[model samples]
Target: MHIPARPRQAPIVAGGLPADELAERLRQRLDLPTWPLPLHLLPPGTALVGGAVRDGLLGRLALQPDLDLVVPTGAIHLCRRLATSLGGSCVVLDRTHDIARLVLRGWTIDLARQDGAGLEDDLRRRDYTANAIALPLGGPARLVDPTGGLDDLRTARLVAVSEANLQADPLRLLRGVRLSWELGLELEVTSGEWIRRHAASLVQVAGERVLTELEKLAAVPEGHGGLIWSLEQGLLSGWGADPSASGRLRSFTPEQATACGLAPLERAWALPLARLAALLPAEALARLHSSRQLQLRSDRLRRWWERLEGRPDLEHLPESRRLELQQELEADLPALLLPLLPAAARGYLTRWRRQDDPLFHPMPPLNGDQLQRELGLAPGRQLGDLLHHLTRERAFGRIPEADPAGRAVAIDTARAWLGRRRD
Candidate 1:
């Protein structure tokens, strides 16, 4: 494919910022003054590129953003040499592609050999215009945008570098959607069409890579919309994800989670869990090679949700059934609350937060050891049944459990119950 002509001598100010100012800003955010891998260590043709550069332009660079540099050659060797001399660690990410990562202090710097003739050729090979942009290191702060990335950034558009690039790495198809929503950019029309055309090929990519992208996409503030768009475009259909579940994502919003008493950290994991469960069933997650813990959470949430939906209210369920619900969802109650009405969700969350709430956080008033020691009870199925009974009694306030007097009352109640069973 013939590449479009890009400016060789760009304007002093592109993307509404002067090159020098942008460079200074990146240096400040990157903390170049205290960098362990000195600029002198890098070869002449190295350039800082990818997300770091893109995020710097948007003034959203993280405190410790990973730095990506395209070197002229021997990227792996350079990384190893730097690691050995600087007393850091070197991880060979891709030996075939000559990509390696240098870990020093708390910073991660990925060094990859330039793909083609020079920076321009390499930039042209990138997946999206925004990521194709680069800034030369150890030189004047000049923006090398072979794909008109600066203009696309200015217009808040996500344009694919080329259809071929998207085809080269099918993961880029999913990445485009994530980047667009994460950065508040719109996917350009032709680029969106290209993504849809190659969506099926995404299944060929590594499951771990696909899972990583999905996790990041699901963590976005309004990520559900992005997931829905991916489904609508058939990006996730090749996998076991049901497009029909997209509506479930639509209804699960950040506001609903907050109303359910999910703090930032709680929402971070809960929202993604709920959203992922909505789109992919346990079997689908297993096929994706997701963690066993994640699969279990998804399966449990889905099963209980289905069961609870059939009942009028979680509170109105039979005592045994309600106790089971509380015990099963003890850790992930907030996630289950996402689809419920705000008031009801708030009530459940409020009770769940109280560590001493017997029903919400069920605990047996008397263990088998305690029963045997205090009441001289034998250990067997009878003991297990007694423990279960005590847990249910405490959960429903039938057995008091807060103080010394409550403990005495609980033991007496247990003795009486055991005597009744004997009779």
Candidate 2:
């Protein structure tokens, strides 16, 4: 029942361009045969904000697609309706937030209701001015800039929507930093002050939410420095991180750290995994407490961190043992290791690159079952002890194969060691 704002004067027709031109252009460019159904069935006043506006404005500025869309009302219902109309699927993400998402022609569009606030109210409530702008759903596609968001976008400045904006949602403090990096915009003084004042409240927000924003910033090709800027502003400390440790970690250039952090083997074979772990601290892994798999990954990373400092006696280890050590080392202290790897370790990694897969190559050949069957051992703690011994042997390249014959010898050695200990 919402009524869209009508242009005050006759649709501005300059250079043969009018208000509906962009919508018409979008309709024409949409090759999907079923687009007409929603175009015809959709009720009026439902605007696609977010990515659609982002891309449209970027297009006006000759930028590429980072498409996102926001539908002001009936967002979830409209997503379902659009999906059915287009023969696609509607994914209801958050019923509470009234958000739904869809993928059309490989472009991601997020749908959300404008609530009852109307455009001006909604813009005022948002985190930043650049994101406060909206483009109309149809016709000349005139932009709705109730908060002068367009001016801030043009100026490449990060300005909060209002003074109360960050206070309303403390997470907005981190979001401001994220948007500044993502859009390559510099934060205005007031916005920076707002973030500094309210940064401590970020801990109250969910860790997953904070981590998501951090991940997005990390994904930016040139946003590392911006992330460093956030850390320098006490944002990480405010979120419960040990500020001194984080500061010390952030002092090195990301490039300098990347050199030591990425194993030569990972550089050649598992570049993506190496790059991913290189930017993060193991501490972030603790934030994902809900995931058992992540916890295990974090534990493995912690063990690796222990190895890098040469805590356990691993000096006399063989190449395979060295490789396993390196894997664990990279996992635990990726952020710390980035700037501290020795030249010898870097060179050794190059010679050990796995051929088939980068992230994980292949499973080890031996296990407890094989050892128990081969060595006539019961399936108990003895079998576990034997497996550990065999793993160490495999790590040192002593176990030639993972077959029954090799497993039998490994178990025999373990039993002898146990017998000697019993004496």
* Winner by TM-score: 1
Per-residue lDDT of model 2, residues 126-218, tens digit only: 778777766655545456667776666656688888768788877788888877765667999988998888777777887777766765665
Clash numbers, per candidate: 0, 13
Off by over 4 Å in 1: 1-15, 310-313
TM-scores for all predictions = 0.92, 0.69
Clashing pairs in 1: none
Which 10-residue window in model 2 sums to the lowest lDDT? 1-10
- Shift in Å, residue 180, candidate 2: 1.3
lDDT by residue (307-402, candidate 1, tens digit) is: 766443476679988898888889988888888777788888888889999999998886778889998878898888888888898999988776
Task: Give the C-alpha lDDT of model 2.
Answer: 0.55
Q: How large is the C-alpha RMSD of every model relative to the true structure? A: 5.4, 8.1
Measured on C-alpha atoms, candidate 1 has an lDDT of 0.84
Candidate with best lDDT: 1
Instruction: Please give the CA lDDT of all the candidate structures.
Output: 0.84, 0.55
